[model samples]
Target chain A: MDKKKDILSLDEFSVEQINEFLIQTESFAEILKRDIKKVPALRGKTIINLFFEPSTRTKVSFEIAAKRLSADLINFNTSSSSLRKGESEIDTIKTINSMENDLIIIRHSDSGYINYFAKNVPVPVVNAGDGKHEHPTQALLDLYTIYKNFTNLKDLKIAIIGDILNSRVARSDIKLFNKMGMDVKVVAPSMLMPEDFSSFKTKFANNIDEVISDADVLYMLRMQFERQERKFYPSIKEYNKFLSLDMARFNLMKKDAILMHPGPVNRGIEISGEVMDIETLNKDKIKINAQISNGVAVRMALLYYALS
Target chain B: MREKATVLNSDDIERIIKRISHEIIERNKGSENIIFIGIQKRGVPLAKRIKENIESLYSSEIKLGKLDISFYRDDINEKIKSDVNITEIPFEIKGKDIILVDDVLFTGRTIRAAMDAIMDFGRPKSIQLVVLIDRGHRELPIRADYVGKNLPTSLNEFVEVKLNETDNEDKVSICWI
Candidate 1:
C-alpha cells in the first residue's frame, strides 16, 4: 500500500494540514536568516524538476528550496528534454520516473496532468503548477506572505484583480484562502470569471474601485496576453480602463492594505508602475521581495513534508 | 498503555536545577563568558532555569539561547510531519563557552546534531553537555559533563522528561513495555 500522499491539489488538504505546513514553513524561513542557509533535511534524496511549461519564479524558487535542503536536483525542462522530438508527455514522464528520483515537481500547461502522474508514478509528486487548474505552491507562498502580516485570517478580505480567466494562481488562492476562512473577491471582466464559480464561494465584480475600499489585501494577477487563446476583452487598452489598478485605484483602497502579485506582473496593465515602485515603509505594507523570500521557505516545507 | 513510574518530582527537579547551575558556574570560573543553548522542547526550560539560578546568585544577566535540531536528525519516519521548534540564538556564539542542555542523554545523537547546528553560527571557545537524565547506551561515544541523575536500564526502557513550561508539570519518568 502507498503510505503517504502526493501533494497534487491544495483543495485536498484539510485546514489543520495546511496550517501545519505554514508553521513548518515559518521554521525554514528562520533558517534562511542564518549565515549558512543549507540544512541536511533531505540529504541523500534526488529530485527531478519536470517543467513542461515556461516558468522562472516558481521553478527557480523550487530549485533554491531543494538545494538549500541539501537534496540533489535535475532540471528536466521542455526545451532540453526529448519531448521536443515528438515524444509523448506520458513517455517523457515515464522515462524520468524510470530513474532513481524520489520526488517529481512537475509544471505542465495542460490541466490535471499532475493528478494523472500522481496515480501512475510510484514515487511522490508535487504540483508546482498544472495549467489553469491550480498552482498550489505559488498560492502557498502567497498565503505565507499574507500570514506574516495578519495573524487573524478569519476576518480578512482579499481582492484579486486582473485576468482571472487565465490565472491558475488566482484559482488556487481563491479556494485555499476561502478554506482558511478569508473572504475573497474577484475583480475582472465578466467574461473572465465563470458563471458556476467551481463551488468555491467568492464575490465577483467588474469594477476595481467597487472592491478597493473594503479590501485588506489587493492581490493583482498578471494580464496573461500570451495565454489568450481567444480575446476576452476588445484590447489591452480597454481592459485597463475597466479593471487595471492604476494610481487612482491604488489610493482608493485602504492605506493599510498591502499589494500582492504573483510575479511577471503586467506592469501598467494590472497595476500601476507606481504601486510596484513604492518603497517599503513598515513590514505590514512591504511586498514583492518578502513574497520571494517566503516562496523559498514554503517550498522547502512542501518538499520536506512530501519526501521526509 | 505501558508500565511507567515517576522518579523525580517538582522539588527534586528544582534542587537538581540549582546544583547544575552551580556546577556550570564553578567549572567556567564565572558566568561572564558563558552562553546557554537548550535543545528545543524540554531543554528550553532547563536552560532558562539555569540562567535564572545564575542570575539570582551572581546578579548579572547571562546569554541564553535555544536550538532546534529537527533538520539534523538521522533517523526519522518521513511519512509523518516532523515537529519543528524555533532556534533563537540572539547573540553570536564566537569565542563563548557554550553549554548545551537537554532533558535526557540517550544515544548522544541529539547532542551531536545540536553541536553541528550551533557551529553554523560561529566557532565557540568550547561546548559542554548538561542533561537531567544520563541513560546508558553505546550508540555514540559521547557523555554529559554535568548530569542531574544517572539512571541505567534495559534497552526496552525509555526516559520521559516533563517540564512545567511545556508539559504543564515538572517530573521525570521511565517507560517500558
Candidate 2:
C-alpha cells in the first residue's frame, strides 16, 4: 500500500527478493504452458498502458501479460489522445487516474517522466522505457536471460556494444548487472560515451576486441540513428567500421558467449547479416525469443509482489 | 448449563484430524479410489496433511488435489482488491470420491463456488465436505460431512479459522461484529 516504495531500480530488491521473484515467475511459466493460459490473479484490477512514443513489442508484450493475469488493460497512445491537441502529460495522467486504474505502465520520450508521474499518482507506476534514462524491466528480463543460461551472475563478464549514450537498455543493464555482481564493460565510440560513466562502475572500451575476449555474454544494442537530428558519423560505411558486429568480430568472441539484442535491429548497420545468421548467435541457438516469454514472467512477479 | 461455543485450540484441531483420518479409513474400507481436494489458499495444506495421515494408516497413498474457486465465486463484485496468488488445479479428477477440505465453513458460499469450479475438471463420484470449524448460520443447504467442531452462533458474529499452514497460527475464534 506504500506508494513511495515503488520499484524505480532493480537495485532496490535484495538477492533473496530477486530469487523469490524468479521462483514465483517459474510457477507462472508453468501456468502459461496450460491450454487456458489465463489466471484470475488480477481479475478485477485495471492496468493502463500509456505510451507517449510508438512501440510494438514492449506494448504488445505488456498487453499480453496483463491479459494472461486476467487484468483489464487500457492502452493510450499520443496519436489517439488529446496530447496531439496540446494536452499536457500531467493532465492526461491525472484524467486516467481519476477513472480508477490500479496500475500504469508508461513509456515516454522525456527523461524523468515516469519518476515524476509515479510521485504524483496514487497507483503503482511501472516504467516500460523512458528517454535514454532507464528501462528496468527490459534490463531485468535481459539479466534473467543471462542468469537462466549461466545459472549465476557472480564474476561473469558481459560486454554491451554500440551506442551507449543513446541506449536506455545499456544504462539499465549496467546498473542491474553490477548489482548482480557481473563484470560489465561498455564498448562505444568516445563521442557516444556518457561523460560520467565512472559512476556506473563499468569499464569503458573503445575497442571491441579489448572486451570481447572473456565475455560470457555479448549484448548488442541497436544504434538510434533515426533519433539523431544530425549525422554522428561521416557515413554509414564509416559508422559500421567502428561499431558494427561483423563476422570477424563474432568469430573472435568466446564459443560459449551468448548473443543478445533488444530488437527492431537495423540488420547490416549494427550487426552483420552473416553474424545474425550464425547458428550460435541466432534465436534458435540461445532462445532469446524465450526472453519475451520471460518478460511476462518477470512482470507477473513484479505485479504480484507489489499488489498482492 | 447453557451450551457455550468454545474456541478450538491447535492441539484440538490436530486430534480432530487424526480422528478424521481414522473415520476416512473406516468409511472407505481402505483409501482406494479416494482423493482429497482442498479449496484454494487455506484448504491446500490441510488436504496435504489429511493425505499424509491417510497414507500413514494405509499402505497405499491417497491422491491429493487443489481447486482454486476465485474465478467461480458468486461474490466477485465484493472483491475490491486483486489477489496475486491465483488458483492452480494440478491434476485430473474424474469419478473419484473427493474429500473437499477447508479451514472454515460458514454460509457455504465458498463451498458452493468450489463445487461449480470442480465440475469443470470432470465428474466426481461424490464430494464430502470437511472443515476444521463449522459455525452454524447456513444461507445455503450445503453442509460439511466431516466437521472437526461445530459452534452455534448468531449471524452477526464472525468465526475466524486460522491454520498454521496459511495464517502462521492454528486456532479458531468467534468474534462479535
Candidate 3:
C-alpha cells in the first residue's frame, strides 16, 4: 500500500488511490454489518478531532470510525477549547501535537487553512471541511455510495445540483468525479456559481432540466446559507422552481438513477420535503441513509489508510 | 525475488492435500460438526478443495467459508500487498469445530490475525489450522494442526505457495530476494 501522509484534498489523490480507498471501504462496510462491529486494527493508537467550526455528521462519523477500529479518539471543539483564551492557532495545534496523537482531523472555517496546518504538524491531518476549499472524505463517501448503486463510475453522468460556489463538498466532489472519469454536470443558478467554474472541468448548466432525464446520479449539495454574504437567489419559491428536486423532476430522472446528498439537507431548498421523507428515502433510488452510513465506513478506511 | 528451489510440484501438492484431507476427517471423526474457513487469497481455494475432497470421500457435506484478516491485522497498512478481499462466512460457527486453512504459515502473524478475525464472527468449539507449507520461524507461539510439508528456511528466504485456482499452477517454492 502506498503511504498517504494526509487526506487534505481529493485534488491531491490519483484515480487509483481513490479507487483503492473505495475498494477498502467495502471491507470496512462489511465489518459494520457484522454483529461485532468493532475491529482491533488500530489498537492503542490515539486520534484527535480538532474542529474550529461546527459539524454534526462529519465529527460523529470520524468518532465512530476511530472507535470502530478500536482507536482512542479525542474531540476538541472550538467553544470549549483554549482558542477562546486568545491562544494562537499554532500554539493550540502545537499543544495538541505535544500529546502525540497518531492523526489529527481538523475542520476549520477558513479555506486552505488545513494545508498550512498540515504542513506544520508532524502527524497526518485529514481535512474534515475547510471553508470553501475541500471536504475530501465527503467526496470519498459519496463516491462509495455511488459505486454501491452503480458498480462502475467511469463515464457515469452525475449532475451535482445546488450551491456550487461556496460548497466545499461540491469542489471536492467535482475533482474526485472528474478524476474517476465521470461526466460531471454542475447545475445551479448563475448567481450561485463561481466565476472560474470552467476550470472545474465539468459541464455547466443553468437548470436541472437539462440533465434530469439522462444523469445516472442526482447529487444534491446543501446550499451554504451561512456562507453567503449576499442573496444568491431571489427566494425559496424561486430556488425551488429552478434547482429543487421536486416529484416532477424526480419522476423524470432515469428509473435506475440515484439521489445523493452530503447531508444536513435543506428539504425545501435543494430537494422537496416529500422526496426526502422517510417513505421516499426508503426507496432504492434515494441514498441519503446509505451516504451517512457509508460515511463511517469510508472514514474508517481512510483512518486505517493514513495511520496504518 | 529469485526462485531458490521448487519444493513441491503439482502432483506433490495434490498428494499432500489428499493426505491432509484424510487427516482432517480422521481427527474430527466426521464432517458433521466441522466447518472449514479459508484465510483470504490462496486459503479460500485450499479450503474449498479440502472440503470437496472430504465430501467426495465420505459423501458428507461440510460448511466452508472465506475469511479476510486484513482488518484484524496488527500491522494495518504494512504488508498489504493486495486489495482487501471479501470475508464471506455465511453460516454460524458458534460451537462447530473450525479447520482454518492457509497456503503457507511462516512467522505465524497471519494465523494469529486469522484467529482474531474468526473470533469476531463467533466462538468455535476448537480451531485447528491446516497449512500447505510450514516454514520454520515462529514469531508467535502458534502451530498448524495439519501440515503438508515442513520446509525449514532462513529469515531471508521466502516460501511462495501457488495454487492452480489463483496462480494458474500448483507449486511451492523457496525464493530469495
Candidate 4:
C-alpha cells in the first residue's frame, strides 16, 4: 500500500508501511491454513530467483511463496550461468532482463551487489541476502513470528545472540526491531561483535546472561561460519562456554519468552542439542520451525508488495 | 464526493430488510440448512440482521460468518481502496446452503472474488446472493437472488450504503465522486 518498488532494505520503509506488510501477511497466512493452499493473485507473472550464493531454506521459501501465489518462477543456476563464461554481471542480468520477468530475488556474497542489480535492472529487485549487508525478508519473517506470539512489540526486549558481525540477519533485525519500538540488545562474543559497533542503535552485551532473564524474545542468530574470512573464535568448546544456550540458560528464560533463529542452526555451538530437543517437547517456545513456516507467508507478502 | 440524493432513509431500509428476509425464507422453503455469510465491512451487519430476523420471526437459528476477499481480488495491478478485513468461517460449509450477503452490487467483481474465496474453504450445497442495493453496472455476469432495492445510476455516481452497526446510521445515498 505504500507503493514501494523494491524491498532491498527495511530502512527505505516507514513504520506504517512495514505494519501494512504485516497486516497483509495476516490475510496471506490465513490462506495457507485453508484446504486449498494456492491463490491467483500473481497469476501469469514471472519471477526469477537469482542466487549467487548457496542457500537451502531461503531459496526454497521464496520458491514456495511464488508458486503459492500462482506465479511462474525460475531459479537461475549460478553454476552453469553465463557469469562463469566470463560474461559481465550487468550484461548477464541485462540478457535476463530482456526476457521481461516481473521480479528478481537475488542473493550474492558481495556486500552491496544487490544494489547494483536493482539499479541496473528495470524490474523490482528483492534482496534475499547480500553478504553481511542485510537480509530484509528474514527480518520481516522474524518480526511476524514475534508478532504472532506477543500482543505488542513495543518495549519488548529482544536479545539477539551469536555471530553479529557477519550475520546479515542480525544487522537487519536490529534495524527493524528498533524501528518497531522494541528494546534490542546484541549479545555475542567480543570477536563476533561488529567492528563499527557504534553505528548500531541497539545495546551491546558481551554475554547472554545479562539479558536472558529480562528479554521477552531470545533471538539466536546463526553462526555464519562460511561468511567469516578468518577464525573469529578460538574453538567451539570455548565458544559454547561463553554464549551457547544450554539447559541452564533455557531455565533462566521467562515463561512466555520465545527463542528464535534465522536458521541452518549450529546444533552444539549456538544452542545445545538438548535445548533444541526441548523445542518439540516444551510449550512451543523455540520458534525456529515457526520462523521457517512464516518465512513462506512473509515472503508472499513481500512478493505481493513488490509486484502488486 | 458530493451527495446527489438520499435513495433510502432509515425506515425504508428496515422495511426492505424485512421483506427480503421473508423472501429468502419462502424461496428456501425453510431456514433449516441456511448459513448466512457476509462480505466484510457493511455486508456483515446486513447479514446479521437478516439472520436475526429469520431467527426471531421463524423461530429457527442460523450460523453467521464473515469473509474478506482482498487476496482473491483480480485487480492486483490496481490499488485497493479499502483496508483488509478478517475472514471468519467458523463452521463447516461443505453440505450447508450458503446465503451470501452484500451491501451493493455494481461491477460484480467483489462477488466474483468472494465466490472464489468461498470455494477454497469447501463446496457448499448452493450459494444464493442477497444484496441491499443493485446499482446495475456489471462487468461480470453476477446477480443477487434476494434484492432490497434496484437503484440504477450513471457510472460517475457512487452508491453509499450505511448501516447502524458500522456507520452509526442506516441510509442509502448516491454521490458523485
Best-matching candidate per DockQ: 1
lDDT of candidate 3 over B1-177, digit per residue (tens): 999999999999889889998998899888899999999999999999989999999999999999888777766545432367888887899999999999889889999999988888899999999999998888899999999999999999988889889999998899996
- Please provide, for model 2 over A200-302, each residue's C-alpha lDDT reduced to its tens digit, 9 standing for 90 to 100: 8888887677776688888888889766766665777876777777888777778777878888778898788877666444553344466778888777666
Q: Per-residue lDDT of A1-308 in model 4, one digit per residue for the tens? A: 35448889999999998887787788778778877899787888899999999999999999999999899999998989888989998789879889979899999999999998898888899999999899999999999999999978899999999999898999999999999999999898888888897788778898888988999999987888887889999999988887889999999999999898888889999999999887777746888899999999999888877876
TM-score of chain B of 1: 0.94
| Pairs clashing within candidate 4 | none
DockQ of the candidate models in sequence: 0.62, 0.14, 0.55, 0.52
lDDT value for model 3:
0.89
Model 1 Cα lDDT, one tens digit per residue, A1-308 = 65655888887899998887887787889889889898887888899998888889888999999999889999986897788898997887678878998899998888987898788888889998888899898899999988888888886999898878888898899989999999888888888876667565788888888888889998888878788888888877887788887777777778878888888877777776777677365346647778888999999988888886
Who wins the TM-score comparison? Answer: 1
lDDT of each: 0.86, 0.77, 0.89, 0.89
Q: Which whole-number lDDT from 0 to 100 does residue A230 have in model 3? A: 88
Candidate 2 lDDT (Cα, whole model)?
0.77
Ten-residue region with minimum lDDT total, candidate 4 chain A: A1-10
Clashing pairs in 3: none
RMSD values for the candidates in order, in angstroms, are 1.7, 5.3, 2.1, 1.9
Clashing pairs in 1: none
- Give lDDT: candidate 1, residue B130: 94
Q: Rank the candidates by DockQ, best first.
A: 1, 3, 4, 2
TM-score of chain B of each: 0.94, 0.89, 0.96, 0.97
Which residue runs does candidate 4 get wrong by more than 4 Å? A1-4, B58-60, B77-83
Q: On a 0 to 1 TM-score scale, where does candidate 1 land against the true structure?
A: 0.96
Error of 2 at B131 (Å): 3.8
Error of 1 at A19 (Å): 1.5
